[model samples]
Target: MKKAAFWIAALAVLGGLQLFVRDIVGAYNYQILVLVGINIILAVSLNLINGYTGQFSIGHAGFYAVGAYTCAGVVVYGQEAIRGATGFLPELGQNTVLLLVGLLCAAIAAGLAGLAVGIPSLRLRGDYLAIVTLGFGEIIRVLILNVEAVGGARGFSGIPQLSNFFWVYLGVVVTVVTVHNLVQSSYGRAFISIRDDEIAAEAMGVDTTRFKVLSFVVSSIFAGIAGGLFAHFTMYLHPNTFLFTTSFYLIIMIVVGGLGSIEGAITGAILVTVLLEVFREFGAFRLVNFAILLVLIMIYRPTGLLGSWTLVRAGRRPGRAA
Candidate 1:
């Protein structure tokens, strides 16, 4: 009953904020909130592979681009078809359903891309895996650059703005909860075992390669969903937007937040988003400031801002000393 009440209260608060916050706040602030939510999803999803599962992937942007472009393409071209299929629903309901469907499609597309990349690449470790993923990311960007159907280098435009606070926040919530649950499960232990020592995990019958691919695929799914929301929110898609540099930003978020920590991911995402905005005031000097701050963080607290601190840990009783 207490747990139920807590959930009910949480849902009520979320519903109230989603339904009323935008109306009360300025558009700029509301948009920033939405972006933060999206980043939380991205950072947490990536943490599954890079932190919990212990894989270093620098090609998340490739999956992100895949999701964004696929979603935008559907919105721009498939609306009529979707409308026909959902003709029974009211106009607003139809649009909402289509948007959700588009997001799901984006997730699937990115997961397939992850599978293709992961099957062969997961065999390698460390720098080899990183190099392969990086190359994959570049390949994706190049493909998008030459694909004139999706606007090539000119950029895809005229996408409708279907992303709202509700959807973005809901995505964040779902991603966080799902990842948190996964990390506490037996599969999560296998992932951690692989991360700690792949050979030992394999000898123990953990199926390291399979779990690695599964982690990558799950990470890509949420990354894709984040990309879909970003595409709709910005109403534009550009291949350059998902460049290696974007992936670097994501890495920085997780690193600064602390790998293997969901709370850290959320905190780091929000912190980085705000810092980016704040640094924007410095104009050309923003990157310089950002770099210096990151360097300082590395020097002082190499583990990250949260350093593996988890919200779940806060509620648990301390273990007895040996």
Candidate 2:
């Protein structure tokens, strides 16, 4: 009951903030806020596998693309049928229902893709795993590039703008809270054990393979949801948008925020998003400056700004390890 109340309160706050942003925030800043929320989801989900499970996966973009395309296809093809079936619903209601359906489809499709990849590729570890995942991401992009049904190299367009600040931040809240709770559970202990030492964890009778695959599937589900939100918000999709560099960008977020920390992922997402915007002024030198900043952060902080710290409850001290 207490947990339920906390979530209710959080949702209430998110609703209030959404109204505020819709009413007062400037367009540019609003876009940034939504982007930050999406990045938070991506980073947090990836952290589940990379940080807590000690798995190296650079193919998150593949799952992300799967979700986006799946959601877009559902929304585009099913909207008319849904509208006809529920003509009595108001426009907002209809759109909400459609969005929910799309999100569900996206999650299922991405989860399946994750299972397929995790079962075979997860058997490999370290650099080999990274290489496999990276290749998977590129393979997804190239496959999408050749698929004319989704617009091929041209891009998928005409998508309805169904996502908003409320939905995006709600996703952020869900992702953060769910991951935090998961980390504190028995399954989380198993995941952490694997992260600490896979061989030791296996010796201790933990089914490392099962836990790793489960973590990967859960992580991919959230990434797919984030992709669905992005697709609806942007009202377009392109194969290039899910490039291997996009996966790297998410990696940078988790690293900057500190691995194995939910709060760290959120903090990293916000900081990286804002800093990228600020660096946009540098034009040709943007990547150079950003790279330098990251190097400096690593050289100085090493463990990142938060360094595995998590949000503590009231009456408890802060900076507690996750």
Candidate 3:
């Protein structure tokens, strides 16, 4: 079929590019690619609840951090001194079962945290909801700071670095495909209906509350998984990693990328991630640039760079550029 050929050609192009660019790109560029994957997952997942399902949730970082810390704890406790004895990859591969279990546990912990926050907070709307979610994020951060067992204020050290671009991009591909399918399916139709008009959606027999919770829980699970990958890849994680600043960056990504489009998510993630990394050497003023970029994007092209484009769609187009 055309779709199969499209995917094959796209893969060929990507393979060629990897061969050509592998020697030229720096380690930091690979890091950026990893970040791109993470941000894509984060932004798209948030979109499920906020954009597709029409809910306001600012506490996403809380679940993100929960997955991260939970994963780290398992790896640390399961391996114990092996963390100090060797590195993340060594300890990680030796106990593949434990690692997978750790990741799963991380997702469960985070999804539960999402339910904890969503149960009460999802009741509120508009500004009130934002405040509650924001509060939840702050509570998580402060709690992490006080938990001495996880290294608390000083941060956790010795996390393994087993994540690579393959895992990161694989996550990105999966997140996009998964959310895309969800949106285009029956449940996704309900989600879109809710977004269009909640009162009407419920009047039409859609269980708005149940669907909202479902979307929130699903988003949190994937976001948590991304966080787990992040923690392991970077090998160092702290409460500060999931602070308000992180939430802020993620918001920027969603805002800059069209909220409803997976392509927008990818475009925004790459743009913001690249901007932050490239300008990080600028010190405090780097953030100033970020703010300015946000302002300009909002003012000029608020729909996000790609708007509604999709890689699969692009692949489908006859003679489309690779």
- In terms of lDDT, which candidate is strongest? 2
How high is the CA lDDT of each candidate model? 0.86, 0.88, 0.75
Choose the strongest candidate by TM-score.
Answer: 2
Error of 1 at 293 (Å): 1.1
> Over the stretch 160-247, how does candidate 2's per-residue lDDT look in tens digits?
9999898998898888878877877789888988888888889999998899999999999999999999999999999989998899
Clashes of 2: 0
Order by lDDT, highest first: 2, 1, 3
User: What TM value does model 1 have?
Assistant: 0.92
**What TM-score, over all chains together, does every model reach?**
0.92, 0.94, 0.83
What is residue 214's positional error in candidate 1, in angstroms? 0.6
**In candidate 3, what are the lDDT values of residues 151-230, reduced to their tens digit?**
89999898876555655566676678788888777787787777777788789999887788788888998888888888
As a whole number from 0 to 100, the lDDT of residue 281 in candidate 2 is: 100
| 1 against 3, candidate with superior TM-score | 1
Decide which is better by TM-score, 2 or 3.
Answer: 2
After superposition on all C-alphas, the RMSD of every candidate to the true structure, in Å, is 3.3, 2.5, 5.7
